[model samples]
Target: MNKVVCLAALAAALGLSACVSSSIPAPEVTMSKVTRGMSQNEVIARVGPPDRMRGQNGNECYQYALGKYGDVPFAVYFRRAAVVASERASCNLSITRATAGPGIVWQASDYAATRR
Candidate 1:
């Protein structure tokens, strides 16, 4: 009936308003709790789930939105299932390629065509 529909709509609006009123913790505060050498599980437990993930070969990078409104980029790198580095930047795995040299070499470009 019309009464039931109105009641349902009011309840839905109230629920949504409650969700919007809740506060989100600052990204820096959360990211600070994560540290290098931590396992993936530990990282998740400390900072909750990542917003996105990228990987190439055996390496993985978890990306999260930074800033007060979650508009900036942040990334945590993992190698061999362990945390290797954390940076206030985003990375696309395709930007890197395996070199036939001794150690890993990162190109000096922030944006580039993907390597095949």
Candidate 2:
């Protein structure tokens, strides 16, 4: 019985660690593994799909807004199915694309959290 309880606790811990909450920095939320030449599907598999996808099928940018006080918005620009570039600033997130900014708009007061 004691062994069973310990195993269950371990499993619960492991499961919770996999979910990256909105409070966590975007880059820390599985973005470090993203690399050039990785297919869009791979990007999705690694970090989960972006909160917002813009542009068309081939040429697109996947944006994940940290929305926290000091987090720099992270975006992966994909061209022809692979990541081509990433921009540090100019981002937005929303319930729908209706109010989403076309690009990241980092304000002067916004600072990238250094440690994160």
Candidate 3:
């Protein structure tokens, strides 16, 4: 009986923690400052490195995992070291041929959060 009660309390605490985890906001990307003529290094300095890269050479897609679920990805297309477009992708979708991809970039409920 004591063990069951302790387990129940632990579970409730965990649930509450997850509900409140995102109360701290993510760092915002100053995307408006990123311009077409800037070099890839310049963009990275502002928007940070993307979660994934979809192409090679100076032309490539830089995908940043964002939105509510974090599984939502947004890509900034660059050609010859210049920005072409920046757009959010469909929910739970990728523009690449990857058979599998990463989950939410940050998950409050994951086991890793508890690690020292």
Error of 2 at 72 (Å): 3.3
Best model number under lDDT: 1
Query: In each prediction, how many residue pairs overlap at the backbone (N, C-alpha, C within less than 3 A)?
Result: 0, 5, 0
Model with the higher lDDT, candidate 1 or 2:
1
**Local distance difference test scores for all models:** 0.69, 0.60, 0.57
For residues 17-106, write the lDDT of model 1, one tens digit per residue: 999998788777877887888988898888879888665442567888876678878888777667877878885564322211124444
List model 3 lDDT by residue over 1-116, tens digit each: 99999999999999999998856234244446567677778878877887877544455567777645576566666656677666666212233212122332322421121111
Give the poorly placed runs of model 3, Cα more than 4 Å off.
1-30, 90-116
Worst 10 residues of 2 by lDDT: 107-116
Q: Which ten residues in a row have the lowest lDDT in candidate 1?
A: 94-103
Candidate 2, residue 102: CA error in Å? 20
Every model's TM-score = 0.59, 0.50, 0.48
Query: Residue 17 lDDT in model 2?
Result: 75
Highest-scoring model, TM-score: 1
